[model samples]
Target: FLNKGFNVVDSSVATGKIEVSNAYKIADLTDAGAISVGKQLGAEVIVKGKALAKEGPRNTGSKVGSYIADITASALRVDNGAVLGSARGHGVSRNISEVTGGTEALEKAAREASGKIIDQIIAKWSGEVSGGGLIQLTVRGIGEYSDFVKFKDIIQGQIRGVQAIYQRSLEGGIAVLDVEMKGNAQQLSDEIARKNFGGIPVKVIGASANTVEVSLGGAVSAKTMSTPPSSPPAAQPSPPVPAAQETSSFFEADEYLVFSGDRDENGRVGKMVTRPTATNPEGEFLMYHDGQKVWSKFFKAVRSAAASELQLGSRIYFFEGNHKEGVYYSPKDKSEARLESWWRDPVTDNSLVNNRGIVTVGRYRVDVSNAFVEKK
Candidate 1:
């Protein structure tokens, strides 16, 4: 597995004195038991299976030993206990010695099964990264609602290939956001450490395949980590503008974010930086036109009316809208995706539809027809 580029956990690590409630019986472990063991080993995916060797057809001429082995394996994502991929393989070997033949057959079967499992896992990873999959982001140490707001804006402003950010919940100073990005959690976590989010210090506490844990204001000490208040504070309203400033505020135009195209040697899209300076790192699937950044995936702000009606942990869908307006349509792909809520955009006339289970992230189409809540 290490030779195959996977970070494998040593078998010896689980050999003795391991902390699990299953009586340390590997053969009788259930899926939940396997997940607990994986968590102890700090593994993102755990591959576990059984192998069986049985008698095979004898040779015609010579009296030779024959054995056939069957191997089955599965790769599972530890965080959500999702079975990413699985495979089975069989091998046959003939030798004068029965034990040697059985051993060779078992080894061959294990090799074949591992190869198939690896291939399937890699294919699934590629499809998710390119198809705008959702990466679960957990931000801790966010005591202020404004900080939560700023964090969302920071993700929107800095990250590349991010179509939408769904606010899942805020509890105990931890905010859960489901971000749809054209990359994996590791890539997003790396980017979070590099950029500055309005002077807020952010740190990547932990990261898995599709989940990232972030800490605001750097690391939190055990003494400082306390229970949140019984009720969350309401978002503070913006201070009222003076009479003189109110008159001048109308002249300030809405400044849509803009960027310039950055491409690499193969013409693959690079990072879209605002200034394109040496300090700025390039992102993926981003292009700029008229100094305004146009992303391959973008989401409009959900109207206030729509957000108020949304219930926590309920899925929604969008089915109608004009190609023009805030919506961007692509001729090549016309799939309807769940557009994340943007905090900065103006409220429009878009409505909300009460539907679930139909979601397909398009490379270029923006679903402006409706707004809906996501179930955890």
Candidate 2:
């Protein structure tokens, strides 16, 4: 959920700590137990979930068994023991193996439930903000006590709709503030991103529905980087871009390949296609020959590509382009691929376009000379 802008606690770390403490059974944990565990893990919210799976049907001739799974999840605010929201999902799968089918069904259900629960939480937070509620601000890079005091003053005096600020804790240049504001954390973050506090550079690093994380460019020499006090100019802040996180996408065996051609000297003959998988949301190049995947490599896109790029039809195709160094296709044979889309990078504020004829898996090059362009 980092892409959604919340600082998520690692699940493995919390699980390991809970396992060692002999805490309440995860499946049957109470609200009190959840709050205790959340406090121990320094988490503001705790998400609890359960899954149930059952075999539905069996086709003996085809050796395909059907399984159904149901998943339910809820988010709890640890401080108040309040239920933010809950969601449920169902999934069905058919597989030759019973265990595999059940597992797949459960995974699908979990993904659906997780997404809905996250959406609910964000909606709830937005409502709370509109009603004038509390928001948490994590400020870092404070050079001294004076710097933090000045920062707090700026928030209270300059920012609109700020009711009050309560200092939760401050240690090692990091301070957590409980802010009572009429506006949401995202709005506050965006406003802060555009300001320069007395020539102290500020950046909004992370922001969510209820929380914002900011860093000040202060440590060694703040005055050295400061401009004249009389000539202060406002700068348009670059929007934040969410970094890549780990995710997995399920693909069936009958997945289609987009473009293929004759084998090169390395015996790598196949169609090259792009897929935006969970692991590589940017995109990856997959090569397949005779309906079998030969190799796959990640592709650097101008921006995040759409998951629709992996459609199981002839929507993907090779286009004619001039052959260049580090590219696999040439115009002479008319076997090149180009992405004819453009997107603006929020962080860099730059227009990016992806038009490539390159196809390589590590040190090996794949031939695409005889490939023909086809689109559905």
Candidate 3:
């Protein structure tokens, strides 16, 4: 749901399992362990959801099988346990995959419900949903596939009001949408500032009391994010080992994914991390500082490489993670070092994509001989 500008953290089975008996249960973060989760993942807000399509009996519809998916969810601010929004919605799908067992209906339903949940969050944070109508919306930059669909869904399904959406034009990567909403233009702008429809984030440049104008670099506001100005609580750099709270941030991070392997010769461990924000967003970016962070695992692993192939200790960056998992780098030699790991193929029946016949695929990473040509 947060694949857009919102950080996609991995609480990783840590939030535990929240099961409901075929009813929408409003989750209470206070008792559901919200603080531990907040500290674990440096998230501004958290959205929790689930689907129950296979609970009863097998689908008995068409050849592909008919499935109904219902999703109920709520949001919370990590810094302070404050419930932001809660909602439930359902969707119907006939694209059930028996060969690979992927729930298309459930995913469809969840997205439908999640979009509504986000609307509520925006309403709560920006204080707008109830009063708005006929606002001009101009979105430019990053008009990708995901953005188009999500924007369409939001306009079509406003929680309270929004009678019609008239498309003015879509040209030169700029889209002009006329939202027949009930609130004022400023209210609409404030609400748009908080949303990350699908994976596209649009910025509200300025909104007249009468008309709202939004651009694309992904609109963002701390109030809507639920993260106070003092989020992530910068830690002191004295101790090599971080406090328990700091440790959770690393495990919960969605910005840079960190992986661990056996310890290096110098008591260090191999770790691979990626900075999703710095990447090209349009293409795969696999380099340090530019769009990737390699120090923790890349440099440490290379530091322990045969004959110090990376020539360890050229320039060390004050790594983002804790001290022990810190990264070191040398621009000249760091780019050439290769690494390998496992990856899971998507749940699909296509043998071409799932040749291994299972999710886990071993020996994935390989070092390219040529250096990356930096894009201007």
Candidate 4:
């Protein structure tokens, strides 16, 4: 009797190799049940089959009967519900030999059926990968649906260069986010690092020119290599403040910060500075009417809030009202500029929504909205 069962077995030959599992009865391939088994089997693609064996018409009244088998199967991508293509196989007994030739016919039919389906799977995968620069990015440590939601939010908000996020899959407690980013892998990883995700610590563990792996709740190591620190920057004199420049006691500890548009001295158009102790900025305001020398006078307490972000050094930094853009810190010495914000903005409002702007940095933030008083 012909073995009328669906066999998904991998075969090996001197010329080729494939890793397939034992055949399965189509009735047991329930949608949910098949997915679970497929995951355990590490199946890259799934194949479904249907076939039939019948007596060949040529089996005219001869004592030996001829048999033919026709088989077909469909291939599908595991992660996405993408249908690759359908493949079919046909087989006929070479010569009626034993009590029945259907067994041989079925065997031939099964081999051809599997070969065609596997080919369809390979072609579909090749098209997906080599066509539109689609990359397979996997982010691990995503245990639940809510985590996926947050991860999606962070990716869309923090990554600006991504053209699209085509698919997201949760498997083996790992979440895979497939996206097409504009630059190579390293560039994409760096861009993702610049933005704050608020909760989980994200690290780019593996990256190639295309494929990338993002790990959640992981710490990124600091780069050890460095250029010899340039001989200490040459000593430069501080900019000259107007004789009538206001001074404030708040800056007694050198807590003062200065900001100017361009290199200093005299007629620079956007020149501005903050004198933390300045009680009144009227004199400096009239000097450069475009509101230079903002000082600490403009800051009025809108609200007092604490930070709940993971990257912020301390839970302090009162969050000034939400200003998407942070003011530039123009120090006389062009060392790496760092902003130490004292107030923190509660992220429950989704403050870190985009990649281009700074949500929070350092340990201090001034009331930016209130910090600027237009020269009314």
Highest TM-score: give the candidate number: 1
Candidate 1: tens digits of C-alpha lDDT, residues 177-217 = 77868887888999998878887878889988778998887
RMSD over all Cα atoms, model 3: 21.8
TM-score, cand. 1 vs. native: 0.45
Model 3 ranges with Cα > 4 A deviation: 1-4, 12-31, 55-62, 99-102, 128-376
Position 289, candidate 3: lDDT: 16
Report the C-alpha lDDT of model 2 over 164-215, residue by residue, as the tens digit.
7756566566767777678777778987887669977788888765678888
- On residues 205-278, what C-alpha lDDT tens digit does candidate 3 reach at each position? 76554456665543322112122224211211121221222112112111222232222111111222332235
lDDT by candidate, in order shown: 0.53, 0.52, 0.40, 0.43
- Name the lDDT value of residue 306 in candidate 3: 20
lDDT of 4 by residue, 73-136 (tens): 5554444423444545778885656435787898898888777656655554454444433455
Range of the 10 consecutive residues with the lowest summed lDDT in candidate 2: 341-350
Which lDDT value does model 1 have at 332? 23
Please give the lDDT score at residue 134 for candidate 1.
Answer: 69
- Cα shift from native, residue 375, model 3 (Å): 66
Backbone collisions counted per model: 2, 3, 14, 18
- Clashing residue pairs found in predicted model 2: 259-271, 260-270, 260-271
Off by over 4 Å in 1: 2-9, 13-32, 35-45, 56-66, 77-84, 124-134, 141-150, 166-175, 184-187, 190-204, 208-210, 215-376
